[model samples]
Target: MLDANLKAQLQTYLQKVTQPFEIVASLDNSAKSTELKSLLEEIASLSDKITLKLDGKDERKPSFALNRIGENMGVVFAGIPMGHEFTSLVLALLQVGGHPSKLAQEMIEQIQGLDGRYEFETYFSLSCQNCPDVVQALNLMAVLNPNIRHVAIDGALFQEEVEQRQVMSVPMVFLNGEMFGQGRMGVEEIVARLDTGSADRAAEKMNEQAPFEVLVVGGGPAGSAAAIYSARKGIRTGVAAERFGGQVMDTLSIENFISVKETEGPKLARAMEEHVREYGVDIMNLQRASKLIPAAEQGGLHTVEFESGGKLQAKTVILATGARWREMNVPGEQEYRTKGVAYCPHCDGPLFKGKRVAVIGGGNSGVEAAIDLAGIVAEVTLIEFDTRLRADEVLQKKLNSLANVKVIKNALTTEVKGDGSKVTALVYKDRATEELHTIELEGIFVQIGLLPNSEWLKDTVALSNRGEIEIDARGATSVPGVFAAGDVTTVPYKQIIISMGDGAKASLSAFDHIIRNS
Candidate 1:
């Protein structure tokens, strides 16, 4: 189960273990259990401080617990931790063996100080790129606070539990057997949810801050670039993002980023964040902007209101809020979301293995999803509203070659049919024949495109009919001293490189306005 190169790396990582720990595994005579045992034995062979025990009795077989010597830290992995979760396993071992985490000191203290019992069960897939963050975050928290226990279960391995819970997405978290959240979430966001007073405290702290020379709203590539460029000018810069990394975090693979051969979304987002942190920009994460109030006077500070009731003032505001996945908005869609309807093929595709699924849209994303799902799912129905698929020739050809995939063009998704607990079928209308068709499927993946997150600026700034913030070449919006960039604005192409360039241009334009007005 363990390769030579991987074993050597694991041995190197285990050298940092300062204390003794044991792997308590619950196993049966299953193939996965045997594989898991082999992996655990290889890990234990690397370090003398590590011990493996197969005498455990957990209802979830093929599961294991990384417990500190004589202490039950309550961190469990129900399936073999490979693929994306392999890093999570390594980190758990080191942290449980007394190695320190790289988490901020402030956050460490917050996790340790958090009161009440939090029994978190996060269901994830091995192929999912976003599951590690949530698993590692919760594992770290469990290691820090005894009251907080986390069990990262592989949904594929625990299909019964997943079906009973009506989970159709990766990284679906349940707290005390109740649904906590779904999708990507960081430690800060998790802590904020558990500690209700954190919001009030954060809001109060924001109220005491001085007005920034450049305040960037959103923390995608655009916001990060804008912040870095503005901070390089030696001005007071700040960035308040609802969730730093934005849509980029949801992206699975980024091949056309330019220069870089290949990279994943979360990895690129981390690098961008670290680059921005090198500057003097004050970044406020998990801060949602509810409204934008322009400055009363020409040289006055503009106020950006937050959903948490926190407000921040800035001389010039750069909107880089980016975009979110466009929804089908058809009947039963919202009701079946996570019950069977999902947007991300990379994240939620594994849950539909051996099942029939539908991919809405015929663009690159839709075609790509159909191709990817063809390998895992029993069948993939690619439905396109356009007369033909708009994907690249190569992708369309590849999708057409797939035996398990079917393409239906000029079909408009009308309604998502579900059995109250999960999706059962999808309804669509044929544009040419004006006939309604229903395709029975277990899941629906919406991959149409993105919608700009510019609803808050609809009333304050000049917006296009499509709700994008209107901006000129200088990135200046209709409101003086206010600028927009990236997907939120009326930009032509919503590429990462283009967004970064737009961000830098907006920052420079904002600086020019500031100097002239001053």
Candidate 2:
């Protein structure tokens, strides 16, 4: 089904496969299986070193086993492996064919030295952007070592088992018959869990508690800065964060983040966390703050409770909970979320390479998405609701310079249109004439605005109508002994540098409060 260009690229990549590998399909004569079988045959035909074997009976929908000709590695794919999963299938093949994994040496050694036989069954949907990373990580480990084996299952195909196992989300992984996690996870994080042999401590919980003088409640750039600044004061500082790097992790290219010429999301996220790690701050990953309450009538200490029942006591608190992508709330948007609609372009852009895509919104985020996708995709259509583009002059100029990109203004995106399996098109209305138009495209990216992640802090702190926390010039909140910063606050012009500065200001404000009270 691949075009000539894609086929050529695949051949070039497959040339790196030095070892002979066999793909055994245990599929029925169903329509999905028929489609998958044809794709497999076409892929196998690309390289002389690869072979495809078909089995018509003894099946559960459409599943395949990847094995070396002379060896039984027990690696399987309990799904059709299309869409983004297509990338996973190719990477798995290359991994088996002697292509070295992108994983670090330390992680590889840990997987190699594992003691017992471990079997990982990961469930995912076709539209899940994060599924391939987890699957590829496990598959790489399995092909590299004999003791470990993995089966990446399509959740939709195996509904009966998924329901029985209570699998409710995409990329839900299980190790040795227990649930590992329910969201996107890094390879190193998973390896550390396996090393500890404790599924209970999976990136979601902080086992023990140590009181702190200052507690930072977010993990993004602002929260990191707040925690780092607080720790520098020689006070016991701790950070309780759901995930570090916050909204910055979803950002693709950060050109304006001072001193950094150009960098991707994941790279910048790692550097920000590494800088924090150099300090004495106690960081609790995967911890989301669920409640806030005064510790006692004295009001010296406050309690920050987590969703995991973990609690920490602190004399002061910094609310740096970041913001998230805003949705278009249009028709077919929710239905085709992963199928053809995506929010984090950086994470899912590669899956749409060479395809026609539409980006909703003409703001900096939307324009930047268009600029980034234009380079990889066949074409990019940017639709804005306003009459004029809202992106910075430089960004707009950069976007205008791209020949493959088209900018349409005064258009309201009314709906996202897609087939049952994936996105197919977009529907919009012209504001000037009220004329409705449809664009045939493979993907739609919604980047309208950002919503602050402060819903849980309701009734505890003052919040604006938009739900962002209200803070003073020094970043002090309405409540005493509590401060706020970042995009989560009433800060204007949400930027990484601005958030970091707000974090530093709030931290110093908190330290000043303590010093004066003492």
Candidate 3:
């Protein structure tokens, strides 16, 4: 199961384990046990010092325990570690089997100060990119204190359990059998939860957030960039976001951002976050914006509310909420998403190279995608629901120039056909003739128009017909003291570089608003 390079790396990492540790597997001898057993045995086989202990035929669900012979190190995996979460398992093994934690004394003390026994169960999926961050943080918390016990449940392996628990989202955490919360969380956030005397602690903290001179809603490149700029102004700045990275996290490869020749979405996202952290930005991450209330009276601060009942007041606000690709709610579309149905051509185009693929939508994105995919894929079928292509003339010309690309107008994508493992074909219906057609393709790229994440602000701020927040060149909205930027605004060409510039402008404008009011 372990490849030669990976095996060598694991063995090398395990060599640093100063204390004798056992990789224990508690199983009920079920089908799920078979898969986990194979991987565990393989890992244990690599190191002579490390041992694998099997507690077979256990009444409880399958779980992996990391510990010494008698003492339980407090880290247990209730699910198989695979997918994007695989790295968490590797890191956990090394951390649990090693010496004292490298965490600062303050952080260690914070974990130690927690009062009661904390038994955490985190449910996650393998494909979720944000799941590992939550799992790792909880696992580390457990490792630092014997009173803290964490169980990382792989949602895929424990489907029935997840369903029974009504776990609709990955990284859903349960503390002492009660739902804690969901989404990505940091170690400090967990500590905050523990520091809370009651379960409503998170809500209380949210309601008690300090007012900011500048509040940047959203944490994508634009929002992060805005927060950094605002923080640099020496003003009280805050940023609220569901996830810090936004669509940037979904991106795979980026080549046209400037300066940097090539990069990945998540990598760039990390850099953006690091840059923001360098500033004095009060980042309220994993907080979703639900509503916006304009400052009624002069000098009154505008209040921004979150889905979690968290609220922040700011004299000036910068709306940098980003955009998302519109999805075709067709059969097998969600099932095969990330498998074969991709939204970004630049991200997943290379994987479809030499394979037949279909590009849905004929706007600039669709035409551009047709041109981009034509160079890589064997055959590119560009489908549009309209009678004519809505893309720019230059893009249309470039797409037409490509021999391998074919454009079909007045066609609506009806279904994304897949074979459980991957996409195999695309189904479409001709709008004009009402003729249904199926195209054999390995990949389906949806290039439909992007939808701005400004629904919550539609009534509060001036919004365009397309649901984008309206803003002047200075990032000032129609409402005073409110600024809008990024794809959520009425900005042309919603590229990452442009959004970053927009964020900077919005932040600077927010600073200006503050000074003028002062």
In TM-score terms, which candidate is top? 1
Worst 10 residues of 3 by lDDT: 196-205
lDDT of 2 by residue, 177-293 (tens): 887775577665677667774334533345466667889999898998998898888898888888777877655457887887987565677788888878967777767889888
Q: Per-residue lDDT tens digits of candidate 1, residues 344-455? A: 8888988998999999989988898999999999999999998889999999999989999999988899999988889999999999999999999999999999899988
Write the number of the candidate with greater TM-score, choosing between 1 and 3.
1
TM per prediction: 0.98, 0.66, 0.66
Sorting all predicted structures by lDDT, with the top scorer first, yields 1, 2, 3
State the C-alpha lDDT per candidate. 0.93, 0.82, 0.80
TM-score of 1: 0.98
Residue 60 displacement (Å), model 3: 15
Over the full model, what C-alpha lDDT does candidate 2 score relative to the true structure? 0.82
Task: Write the number of the candidate with greater TM-score, choosing between 1 and 2.
Answer: 1
